[model samples]
Structures are given as C-alpha cells and as structure tokens.
Target chain A: MGNRVIKMSTLYLTEQGSILHKTQRRLVIIKNKKIIQEIPIFKIDRILIFGNIQISTQALSFILDSGIICSFFSSQGKFKGSLRPVESGNVFLRIAQYERYLDKEFRVEISKTIVYAKINNEIKFLENYSKTNFKEIIEELKKNINNLKDKNSISSIMGIEGHSTSLYFKGLSLILKNKFLFEKREYHPPKDPANALLSFGYSLITNEIFSLLSGIGFDPYIGFFHELTYNRPSLALDIVEEFRTPVVDKMIVTLINKNIIKEEDFQREENSIYLNNIAKKAFLTHYEKRIQNYREIIKVQCHKLMDSVLNKKIYEPYLED
Target chain B: MGNRVIKMSTLYLTEQGSILHKTQRRLVIIKNKKIIQEIPIFKIDRILIFGNIQISTQALSFILDSGIICSFFSSQGKFKGSLRPVESGNVFLRIAQYERYLDKEFRVEISKTIVYAKINNEIKFLENYSKTNFKEIIEELKKNINNLKDKNSISSIMGIEGHSTSLYFKGLSLILKNKFLFEKREYHPPKDPANALLSFGYSLITNEIFSLLSGIGFDPYIGFFHELTYNRPSLALDIVEEFRTPVVDKMIVTLINKNIIKEEDFQREENSIYLNNIAKKAFLTHYEKRIQNYREIIKVQCHKLMDSVLNKKIYEPYLED
Candidate 1:
C-alpha cells in the first residue's frame, strides 16, 4: 500500500547504550534519562548492541517474538555473543548436515574449495592495496591447491590451510597504511587496531553465517575446513574463511585508507588496542552497510552450502573478483 | 577456486522428457534415445519436468545428492508436485510457526496484511494495464480492507479475501490484450491461456515459498489466511496470496503486452486451454526471469514472516509503490 514503509535492516545501540522496553505496543530505547528511539517491533531485523546495553523482560520477549537477531560486542569491538531465535524445526536438514561430515573424501574436497577461495581472495586483496608483488604467496597458494587434489585427509587439508594462511597474512602486512601496523594475524585481544577491527569484523560475519546455517537446520559446530570443537561454531568458521578476505579485510583497508577509523578511536592497553565506543559505532555502521551490499551474495552462498550438504555437491566458497 | 563454476537455477525437461542417469560421476540427460546434456552434480538447483519424464534410481539418487529440486507439471502447465530436500533441522522454528496459529489475534493480524497487500498490488497491476477506470474495484477493495480492521474470525477474513479476489479477477479481465480472453479464473483446468498462465505462475511462486519456509523450519501446512487441509501446504498458500498479483499478475500482463505469449501458443481442449511445449518453455523462461527479478523482495518477505512468527511483530507483506 502507499502508506507502507520499508523496514530498517540493523538497529545499532550505543552511547552508554540504553534500556530497551515495551511502551504502547512498541519497543523504545531510553538513554541518558531520555527516550532516544522507539520502533514498531516489526520494523527491526537485527539488534547490534555495542557495550553495556540494558533490556527489559518485555523487550526481550518481544525480541524473541519478532525473531530478531541480537549481537553483542564489547566496547573494544570484541564479539561477546548473540541471542537469536531457536533452530529451524526441520530435523532432516541437520541429519544431512551431520551425514556430510562422516564422508572423509567429501570433507577434504569441500575444505579445499573453502581454503583455496580464502587464500586466493587474500592474494587479490593484498594486490589491490600494495605495490609489492604477492607472487610468492600466490605461488604457494596455487601449489597447495594443486596438492589438495591428491589429499583426501582432513588433517592434511587443514595443514595446507594453516600454512597458506600464514603466507596470506604476511602479504597482508605489506598492504596496511603506514600509521597502522600489522605483524601477524591475532585473534584474542588484538595487538593493534587493524587486528582488532579484523577480529571484530570476522566475528560479525561468523555470527551472521552461524545464524543462517542454524536457521537452515545445520549443526554449525561440525565443519570440514575447521575441526569440530566443544563450543565453537566450526562450520560457520569454515565458511567464514572464504569471506574473511573480501568482507572483513576489505573493510579494514577501506576504513584505514579513507580515515573513517583512526588511532584516536582506539585505546592502548597492555600491548593491545581496543576500539573506543565511538570507533565501535563507526565500525558497526560500516559493517552493516557492507553486509547489505553483499546480502544477495551471502544468501546465495548459504544456499550453495545447503546444496552441497544435501547433494554432496561441491561447496565453493565466496571469491571476490 | 578457478575450477569452480556457477550453478544453473532450473533445468527444464520436455518431449517424453529424459532418462536421467549418472555416468562417470556426472549426471547426464538423455532424450529421444540420445544423450543431450551432461552436467556435474553440483551445477543444478532444480529440474523442471513438463511431460512424461523418466528417471533412473541412480539418477534420482544423484539428484538427491545434488540437492536438486524436481518440480513436475502437466503439459497444460498445471502443477502436479515437487520433490525437494528434507526440511531444515531446527525444530524450534516450526514450533513458533505452529504456536502463532493458536493465537487468533496474531492470525487475524497477519492475514489482514497479506490480503491488503494482495488487493493493493492487484489494483495497481490492473490500473497499469487497463485504460478503464477501476474506481469500483478500488472502492470495493478499500471497503473490505477497512472492514478487515474490525474482523478477527478466520472465516470472516477468508470471506473478505474471496470477495476481494473475485473483484480483482474482474479487473484483470478488463486489462488483457484483445486476442487473449479471460472470463473467469479456473484453476483445476484453466479456461483460457491467461488463466492457465496465472495458475502455473502461482504454482511456481508457491513452491518457492514452500521450499524457503521448509528450509527455515516452518511447517508449510500451518498458516494464517488459508485454512489447513490434508495434503495442502496452507501456510505457503497464505504467504503466496501477497505475491500472486505483484509477481505473477504483473508478469502475465507484461508477457501479453510484449507479445511474448500469443493465443496460437495455446491449444483448446473442450472448455480449457493448454500451453504448447514452446509456449511452456517461454512461460518458464519468463517465470524464471521474473522470479530472479523479485528474488530479493521474496527473500526479505519470508524473513519478515519469520520475524513476525518468532518475535510477535506485525508481519507486513510486500507492497509495490
């Protein structure tokens, strides 16, 4: 109808955050003793909470009812966790998802596709930002990919991934802007702002894929590229590898090059750089926009993964051209 | 990876269809006693069988392995059935889907949104194609929509939908190209080419939603607008209401106006008309293109429905401006 309105994609909560509560059949955000924003529950898709955001029981229930995905990140842009709706009701998709992991040949084949896509995209990214020839990294990546043809063991596939990623990161170091320093890829408590942004960005994408896979009734804890762990969403991590370069790495480079995020937005603490609240907000905004731009591609990739699991078809990771 | 290739969306099989089988790790399609096409298992998403299509067990297993959806239709373009992979593994999404139906207020609220969007888009479509004033139809639609505000009974809502849809078909009849006759919408056997296309197009959209809902772990049988019936995917039918006019109706009008489909393309059988093989292919091609065009919108609407079921948020149907 003419009176209809477009729904907002992600709701970013910040600035001492706010206490979200139900008011007059609508969800309202209150901050600094003032009402900030009130939206009809239906208008929101995801809630991106940065820092200590408070929520009332009614609001949480409404969120559950709305099936909105809520993502929590620390003040330093570290991913805490997410509160999403329950898994899909279809039990068979999980059975198929689980069944695929039992096939060693299938696991190795798919893992090769994921890691190859990741390394290749990394080579492409570094080539775009740096004048340095990534010939060596590219050569090594190609060799390992060729070796994947003869490899049918998960451990061998993982070894190739680990070795190739180090070379990819070494090339990544050559592309950073002068003020931003990148030595190696680090996950917990990143040593520099770039690493911090990269880690946070990776978490954002991982959460997204996790929700998608879980929503589709896949066991995210079991994966091919990444080994199964007690608590980690290994499958999401496996898929995350392909996207890390084009989605996260690209965002980090653009943020630094364009001066969207700066050293002032990060705080130094015990050999680690933490993104301040303001920087976190900026990052969240950009992260959401980036996701929106690639929403179609991401959705298609998810379906492709589903197809692979159900049909034992090849699972090719996302490769940015 | 460089070796990876994009998968095709739909594979249409015609003319005593084909004997599909696996040969040396590839799925091959044989028609008229000759091999016509051979594609890797991963390259296909769905197989559209228009006539007497034959499949070997090995081929069926290969299709299942490829996770390829198989949709069967009569020569007249009537939907027979579809074979898709098992539903999503998550049991909770379906639980929420079923729970929502128990809440009368929720059912009534969502039904209103769906019917309103359907009527509104129908009015828009007819107005675009008809030179005649649609004031009466528009007024009737508005009256029923306003009446929907006070009505909560499922029967009452369904009554409104039926009445509104009749008026909509009446408006549709006024907009068809001169040679194309559309007296009334007949589903079991479409009375005219227009009606045949309409039924076939609706079937395509319904199946798409069914697969998506199943993938999201919602029981396609449970719904808000349409009443549940044995062997009927009522929920998919309910959601299909909002999409019928905008996606299917608009495409039908466009196909006629552009001369993509002509009266000669159909054969009269007693009182009904059936699309010839060539016409069916044209329609399928256009159908696929149209689906691709609205793919993003359809995906968003499904997510919105999921949001509504899970979060108690108002489910807003897609409204074209």
Candidate 2:
C-alpha cells in the first residue's frame, strides 16, 4: 500500500524498551544509546533501558516533564519499573476508567473495539495474502476467505475475512509443536507445562505487533469493531495477526530447537502452567536477542517509498510456518 | 510519575502542518494548536498536511529536509504509507539494521527484550494490585500501607502478604455469574461465548492502557517479557493487564444484567459465538463516548487513572465484583 523499503538483515540491540504507541507515532529510545543520560529529547515518547542501565533524577524528571514513558530493565532483561509522566501518573484514573467500562459501557465499547480491530486486521491480512499468494489464496477466497471479493461492501469484505482469519489462527496449533500450544481455547488453566509459555508468548507477541503498528504510525487502539474502552490497546491486536506466525510461533520453534527454552522451563500443577523463574530467565535471554537483532528491508536509495507512495510499492509481510 | 495539568481535549486535525513527535515526551503534542481540521487522529501519525491532509510533494520535501518520520494513515485509520526526510531519512539504514537481527547476533539481543518486558509488566500489574488491596487482600501488608509511620519496605511487605492477589485475578470467573464460567485453565481460542467476550473486552481495555502508557512515554514494544519481534506490540499487553477486570469484565456484566445487549446480538455457529456487524458497530459508538466521558475523584482529576499514574500522582485503584 506504501512505498517499499525492506531491511533484509540487520543486527538488533539485545536490550529492550517500552512500547510508546500512538495514532500517528511510535517513540522508542534504545537502552544502548543511553539517551537517558544525554540531552533529553522531550519529543520521544518511550524510553527502553535494558542490561544494567542506571539513571539520574534529572533524566527521570525530564521524562516526567516531557510526559515520556520510561521503562527499565535489569542486565538480565527483567522488566523493572516505569516512570510515567505526571497527570498520566495517576493510576487511580486507570482504575476508575476500568470501573466505568465494567459498570456503564461494557458491551457497546468493548465489542466494537474487537470488531473494528478484526476488520482492520483482516483487511490488511487479506490484502497481503492476496498479493503474496495472489494466485493461490485468491482462488480459495470464496471458501477459505469467505468469498470476500464477492462482497460489494468493504464492511462485508472485512467481516467475512475476520471470521475466516480467526479460524486460521485457532488452527495454528496443529501446525505448531504441540508443546508450544496453549490453545488459549483449550487452556484449562493449562494442565500442561507450556501454559505459561503460551500465555506469556501470546501476550508478548501481541505487544510486539502493537509496537510495529505504532512505529509505522497507525492508531494502536482506534479499531473499527473493537470497542474503544479505556486503556485497551485494540490497535495492537489489529496488527498482530499477520505477525503471530513469524514473531511468536517461529520464535517458539527456534527457542525449543536451540534449547534456549526447555520443557523444564515450564511447570504444570493441577492443569495450570507457570514459568519458573529460571526457565523464564533462560527464555528471556533468547527472546530479547531475537528482537534486537531484527531489521527492516529498504531500497538502497529510495526515500521514494517513504516520500512518495504514489507509485505504490508492495510490502510482503514476514510469515513463518 | 509527575504532576498533571488540565487541558481541554482538542479535536485532531492531520495534514494541517508539520507534525512533531519528540522522543522522551509523553503524548503531549506541541501542535500550533491554532489549526482545526476534524480529521480523526485515529491512525494518523501526526499528519503534516500541507495540502488536503495529505503528504503532498512539498510536504514530503519538507519532511525529507527535516529527517523525521512522515507517517501516513488512511482516513479510515488504515496505515497507508510513510516518508522519511532525506536530510535525515535513513530508513534504508534502519532497514539494514533490522536485517542484522536475522543473524546469530540477534539471538541474545532479542531474548533480553522478552525477559525484561515480562518483569516490567508483571511488576506494574502487581504494584497496582498491591496499592489498593494491599491491606485487605494481604493482612500482613496492612500495617505498612495503612500506617503512615511505617517506613518499612512497603513493596517487600506487600509481596509477602499479597500472595492471594493472584487468586483474585486468576479466579475472577468463579465470582461472576454462571453465564460465564471461567473454568480452570481453559485454553483460549476461547470457545465459550463468555470467553469470547472476555477476550474481546480485554483487547479494548488494553487500548486504553496503550493511550496512557504512550501519553506517559513508555515504549509499548520494548517490553520486558514480551519479545521484540517484527509486527508485535508487547508493551500494549503489559499496560492492558492493569485494567482487565476493573474495566472490560465489569462492563460485560453491566451489559448483560442491564439488558443493554441481548443474546440475539451473538450468533452461535459450530459452537463458536460471534457478534454481528450491526451489534459490533453499536458497541463501538457507545464505547468511544464512554471513554470520552470522564469523572472526578480525590487524588484523581479529569483524565482516567492510567493518566494519573503516568503523571506520577498518588491515586488508588478500586475493584467491583
């Protein structure tokens, strides 16, 4: 849909940062950059620090003053604390908003958030699917994609596609290593050892999707169908669909194959699964490195994609089975 | 967190002029605030509209001159394209960096991100949980929270006494109406209609979380436990957990009990239930308005609780059965 810029291979920073998402921007400060100690860029929204980073009150004050999000982590990549800006620092408002959503307007807003998110996501996915396997998938559009093209309306196209895509997502377990399957649908508090991994992984993957969408400057929550309830990041889910296979599932496979994460990393008791501290620590190492190592592809000389999308460059998303 | 200032909500207008997203700054926009174009800022990344809320050639040239991210979104909130200022647009370089993560160098960096995000989100959630229920949920911590003279390690005391807090979240379904049975570890492709509601509702709630997290300057993607992966937003989930029950679930009960929504809205097919388009749209309209509606409370001002937290003010969270 836009100009194409693909960064095929690059080294990602092993450290991590917070997910500063917005309708128009994603602000991320590399821990390695130590921007916190440097002159404050009050414009940057999220500052992510990892691997034994230290900070001063001045930096913290700057973050607060600028209303930037400052998330911290240990050298081992454990999440530490957040320095939320003032006014936004009110956690009680979050609770009250939560209360209101539950009491006054749950279904109307919550459902719409999900619905719109489904539509936005499915539409993007189908368009990509169409371009990627244009010949093959398009042929099955009538059945697998619920005949989306046949619909004269965009809403109909999105609705039909959303249902079909979800079905595909639900069936992903069959293709994945069963140990990695939390089935979310089948989770009885997960009598299996991988339950915690799945839960954590899904949540992780969803957030990553949110960051990417925001970085690309899309609304992370103003979804079409998903209700716009207080503090819900529907936009994150809206974009996560296409990447789940590549970011979460593929990483799971790689983690398992490399012994970066083991069955022992997960614990099961009475049908519920949890990640032991050690297992979590081990898995976290590999996961952190993977994202920092991630890089996008781009044309050698073209801001053309970024500057003028009038020519319409195609971007095929990364998909991993 | 810091002090919050009250500002009137402004209607968003994209493509009116140059848009700026300063790093480390929370969601505050230093817009020329004089412009007014009702272009919903839903998915737009600070649209610098020199002409027709669009990235015309002149605008692209200016962005290229400035070396900023010129992000674009469709009016319907779809992410359309981006423009990197040539003066500073090294998107090609950024892509090269992304590709490096594909190499072995990526493993360690990626894994670290996952570990830290997990810790951060867990801590944030726990901190919130302890703040309100520390005394009641865990009697041992009561002395520290309730007693102003207790200069002891509030977190440590809460940690030891707040053991049952986990049961509160994990076992919430037990307290709800039988219409929604959150059984022991149910896998969440979420088969039950209630489960579907839970999933969808949680997503919306998380968006609200994103708004606050971003407004406060936290990177939604550089999460602690959630892996940094292409196309995922780990930070969004981290923020979502803080309000799941208080917002989405509560709203769900209200909808069902108040008869605002009916069984007819949900269509059960092949054992899976979904909301029809009409129902879904109706839900979003209401949800948006609800989010727009704000309440006043002690220690909390106009914005929701999440904002208060970001602003760094002391506020308490409340829960409803």
Candidate 3:
C-alpha cells in the first residue's frame, strides 16, 4: 500500500515542461499554456496548484466525476472556490469519522503527540549541551523515570516537556540565524516557521487519518469537530488536530539538531519566506522517508483499528505518549 | 418600505402567462414553476429565500452580475446548491457570523428577559376573577401597587411572571376545549398542536415575526439564538422565541377572555388538529388588530452592560392589551 502522508510538498515540477493546472477532476497540468502532464481525474486526490493558472470547464466535469477535491487561492492570494463532488458520506463512514474525533477510538493520536514532546526534549538537551557541558540531563531524566520511588504528578511531567518545547523552539531560532521565527498557535496556511512546522505536521496527521479511513473503505472528506464548509475538507482538518504538535515538529527538530539543514535553507520574500529549492527538496525527501520508515507494527495496529471501524468496533486514539 | 409580505391568495404569475416566479437577482423565487418576479440583489449581505422554487440560467446570470447571491434549496425542503448567480459568502461575513454566535451578541443572551410583575398582577387578577368566581377572587386579592412597593427581588418578580404564564396557558387551553393539549412550553413545528386553533396561533406568531423583522429594518433571516442552517430561515426562529409566551400566549388568553374564537373553531384530523377557513380568518384578523393596539410602554433596560448592543436605549416592544 502507498504511504498515507498528510504532508504535501512541491518538487518544483523538475519537469520544466509540466505546468500543474488545477483542472476540476485531475491534475491537468500544462506547460507554456499547453497540456504537458495530465494526472487523470481518478488518479490524483488533491491538486496543489501554485502561481497563476487558467481552469477549464471540462476539467471541472472530471472533478465532478471523481469524488476528489481541491481548494485554490488565486495568484493575487484571494481564495478561489473549491472543486468538490457531493457525497452522501455513507452511514458507516460517518461513524468512523465520529470515532476518529471522539476520545477512545482514535489510536494514532497519542503516539504522535508523545513523539513530538520527546523530540522537543531532545532538542532542548542538545541546545543546552551547546551552551554548557550538561551531560547529566537525559541520564538524570532516565534515572528518574526508572526509579519510581514516588509517582511524580502528571502536571510536573507535562511541565518538563512544555519547558523543553519552549527551549527547543527558542534555540532553533538562534541556530537558524534570522532565517526563521516561532509564532503562537492557530497557525494554518502557515504564517511562519512555527506555523509551517505545524501545518506540515498537521498534514502528516491527516495522512494517517486518510489511511485509517481508506482501510475502512470510507471517504475521508466528511467530518465533524470541524464543520463542513464550502471549500474545506472537514475530514482532513479533523484528522490533523492531535498530530500538529508531534511529527512535523519532531522532523523539524531533527533537521535542526543534526545540522542537516542550516539557516541558509530559506530566503525571505515580501510577506513570506520561501524555502530554497535544496531545502524544500531535503524537507520533502525527509518527510517521505519519515512516514515511510514507520514500523510495520504501527501499520498492523492501524489496520486492526480500520477493521474495528469496518466491523463497527470502537478503537480509541492515543491522546498522550 | 413594502410590507415584508408580498401577499397573493393564489400564487402570482408573470405577464407571460406563467405561474409566479420570484427571479429577483438577490432573491430568485419560483412558485409552481414560472419566472414571474425579479429584484436587484442586495450588496452581498445575507441571502433569504423561501417556498419551493427552481431557477433559470438567465436569473443566475443576474446574480453573477450583481455579485449578490443565488443560493437555493429544493422547493419546500433544504438547501441543495447555489443556482444561477450567487456570490459565495466572504471571510468577513463568516467572521461576523462566528462573532455573533460565539460572542453572544444575540437577543437570547438572557439579559433581555423582562418581568413586568405589576402589569402581570393586574392580568392575573382579571383572569382569577373569571376563573374562580369574579366577585370572591377580587375581594381576596389586594388592589394597587401598595403590596408590591419596596419588595424588589428580580428572581421573585421573574418567578411571578413564570407562574402566571403557566396559569395563562392552562386557562386558554381549557377555553379552547380539549381540541388542543399544549405541554406547557413545547415549541410548535407544523405538527404537535392538539387542534387547528393552536396551529393558527402558531401561524399567527410566524406572521408577527415576519412583520416585526420588517418593521425593524432587520433581515428576517439572519438572526441569533436559532442556528441559520442552509434552508431554515433562522431569523424567523429567533423572533418567534421571545413572542411565544408573550404575543401568541397573550392573544390566546384574550380570545378566551372575550369568547371570540370558540372550541367549535377546531377540527380533528387523525392525531392532529387544524383550523377551518372561518377560524383561520378570525385568528388572522384578530392578530392584526391586536398587534396594532399598544397598551403599556414596558422597556427592557439592559443596564450599562447591554449598552454596547444598541447604545443606551432599551428594547421596548409594543405589548397590546
């Protein structure tokens, strides 16, 4: 089975002859305003078109034919209409969606969140190590976990992770050398570095959701928690909520910690920052690998949950590590 | 301003010898399948359409031209899609909508609840006289505001009105006979009333709402409290809420007091009750007259807290005797 990743990145259409025109159905790409590449309406699920593009009605007919969708923003940065096909969203599909949202049934939730916290802690340890020879940090933390002479309060454990996330984010900005800045939460359609990581992480989470839904033969578009709006895929939004803090953040932290991608990885545009080609490629490649490298155990478990969804059994998603 | 109502006993038709079609740019109304009427669209404000209707491409073109709207539903049912020329709602509109909901800038914020205990006392005295031997009840109950003076407790006052409302509903139902069995404060929706008189009373409330929204220059569709689902005119729902215990309930009491519309005015159909033409006309005519008659000038003063809604001025609806 193909890797279900919510995270999407553009490869800059290395095929210079290819122009990704967001046709209604499939990725009816054009080059020099002529058809160069055409991913059939049924083949592709999303069309992330960038820059100026012209749309045709025939493409729309295809989009309407396939139960796929694409949301667009014009070059002038105004939201264009969404290309979506209507669906009854079936009874069982809705049940699974509700399961994914309600506590108890969404299993992918906690693992992803915990991974994020652990990565943030590691980042903090690394940053502090750079500033001082702090060799006792992780060792002491490990020892403390092992020696459960007294059970520490959950808040204290969470407090430690929270401090680590803050420390990691601050240290990351310093290492990026003015290339990035962290921001407050609620960053979608990412406004900055923190938001970018959040959106990217969120995308990865959505991939899991899609995979889970697909396993149950359900369309991952209809959703609750997030309302079904005109252009938004409410299901995608629903799946991404718990993962925004974990996977994407961890990936970014890893890249920064290992010094694989440096401060020079991006360039500042007028009101936004653009990832340089090399950085974008490296990020996409790493993203693909991270989702790909997941152990078969997780997949097996997800399949079990999917089975439960299909057979109408309940499976709860993890909320914390 | 034209009456919020465009009344025609029978559906209106265009000069083209077709049935009435309200193909207005902003409001494309189609009744019994014919394009008869058209009006300029509002400046992309809120769209409000009712009745079962269909649309033509030309009417949609007008909507596109005016950038107003052409959202329609299956006739007498729910919203299906946008037809002809409907401009999709913008972000500001969405934000404003969310603000009205989440921020509680709505009429049902509980602050608007009033307790005119003095006036209610008088009404109660009169009702008691007729119900429990007028001469004896009048002697037992004290007259004037002497007893109520200086004993100011908001809850106590509100409680008095609440109790009076119960008595009023019970007494009115008895006069209307076993034709209607109201379950205290149950809401009506097409069905549920025991007889036609109750249904007529409910319908009378709807008509009053339509008029009230018109008189205030407010859109009768985009209101708070009740949710504005795609097809349901939520504004009508909101206006109807406050008037249930006051207007309709009051009118029913008056009718019983005067013996105007009688128990014979009702007829049973299976499990439900409906009014015949005579009863309908009596109710409608009386409703119109009563709405026009203003007795007391009771106002809802929202203290300094509610001043932000409509300045320092209080809300005062015409309470007819």
* C-alpha RMSD over true interface residues, each candidate: 21.1, 19.1, 10.4
lDDT by residue (tens digit), candidate 1, B1-321:
212224345566765646666786777878777987777766656676665566554455456445566655555555554544432445455546656776788988888888888877877776665355677887888898888878878888889989998988888777778678787788777777898888889887887787677657666767778876544677888878878987898889888879999988888888777787887888877787777768668778888988999998888788877
Model 1: DockQ vs. true structure: 0.01
Fnat of every candidate, listed in order: 0.00, 0.00, 0.00
Model 2 chain A: which ten-residue window has the lowest total lDDT?
A: A1-10
Off by over 4 Å in 1: A1-8, A23-26, A84-86, B1-321
The numbered model that scores best in TM-score is 1
Q: Give one digit per residue, the lDDT tens place, for model 3 in B1-321.
A: 134233211111112212222244444444445433443445232232222222332332333344332332221212333222111312223223333433442434322332233234435535643555343333333232233333354344444445545554454455443544554544333343433344455554454443333223223344444444433445455445444544555676566556676656656566555555465556655654554331111112111212323342343432224
Taking the candidates in order, what DockQ does each have?
A: 0.01, 0.01, 0.03
When candidate 3 is compared with the true two-chain complex, its DockQ is 0.03
What does each candidate score in C-alpha RMSD? 24.9, 27.7, 14.4
Off by over 4 Å in 3: A1-27, A73-81, A91-161, A167-321, B1-321
- Interface RMSD for candidate 1 relative to the native interface: 21.1
Q: lDDT ranking from best to worst?
A: 1, 3, 2
The model with the greatest lDDT is 1
Tell me the TM-score for chain B of model 2: 0.42
